[model samples]
Target: MQLIRSILAAPLLRSRIASIAQLRRTFSSSTSVSARAFKYVVSRRVKQKPAKKTNFWVKQHLKTGRRIKYPPYPYGDSNIFKRSNRGLFGGKFPMQGHSVSSELEKKNLRRWLPNANKTTLYSSVLKKRIRLHVVASVMKTIKKEGGLDNYLTKDKPARIKELGPRGWRLRYAVLLRLKEQEAKRLRGR
Candidate 1:
């Protein structure tokens, strides 16, 4: 029984050595692989690659027009404006400041929230009226751009970057609608 156990243990030890030898040959002999990668392999530590930056939602929305979850704000991310989606503030978010009291000379933290009014915006491209909570700045910009449709469909980087998830979805919807109309018009002709 002792002899049999020794025989089994000898092969197991040899197999372990064989595996190590294979690993050394696989890594050390490959000039294409780096020494750091070989060290990671020997240590059994996996080197994770960095995540690629992508506009995944924009691509997917344009391709499939599928429902997308609200992603993080692209610019000036602040947790204070929790209800940013509830209103279009044009780039203005809630501001935090110290409010001084005259009587005690105490500096208190205060947040100045933008006033959002319920308003209706007409979209000529979509032929629809959208009721939304909008701030004065956003309303002014929309009017300046000629209408809500123009504002949403603008290809400027600043405009695209500042648009939150809700705005992005709305923009894509309007774009798809416009494309469909154009295709139909072309087909008729």
Candidate 2:
């Protein structure tokens, strides 16, 4: 009772007690802000790390050290492999650009299509004939690799890129056939 009497006697303590009671009432009913209440404030001038710049295409060009005339289609957008099933142009796509002949002449847009020919390629491993439309460059590569089997089985990045979907499927089939043949030979022995 004396402590309560002493608290009531002090003007500042009395006002503080009254404010706390009012604050409790306000909190029970609705949200309220008091002058004495502590608040968490976020600083606007807080330091942040800058985002790193990435020049992917520039890096690729620098690594190759050659300007690419034709770039492969984005495989992420759709199944590029399915589209390449028609004819394997070694991942080459038709390029369309404006061709300017003279300084005063208007730009003429033209589509340059690769020369694809239907050719028969023999795979010594699978012992079968494959007839498909292929570009001259692909044919030259197959010849250089010795045969279709070697061309398909080679794990080179350039060769894999040129293979496309049809070649990839053919490689799997050839591998399975080779495995079966090996098993048969072992059984005979």
Best by lDDT: 1
Q: Provide the overall lDDT of each model, using Cα atoms, as 2-decimal numbers.
A: 0.71, 0.67
Tens-digit lDDT string for candidate 1 (1-189): 998778657977879878888888754555653335544445456889898653333343534666544444456443656566555666668788999999999999999888778898877876767777788888888889899888999998888765655576678767777887899899999
lDDT of 2 by residue, 1-189 (tens): 998898799999889989999888743434555654566775578788798653221222323576422234223222533455655568776778988878778899998777688998777775667777888888888789788787778877766666775666666666656776898899999
Best by TM-score: 1
Instruction: Return the TM-score for each candidate structure.
Output: 0.56, 0.53
What TM-score would you give candidate 2 relative to the actual structure? 0.53
Q: C-alpha displacement of 82 in model 2, angstroms? A: 6.1
| Collision count for each candidate, in order | 0, 0
What C-alpha lDDT does candidate 2 achieve relative to the native structure?
0.67
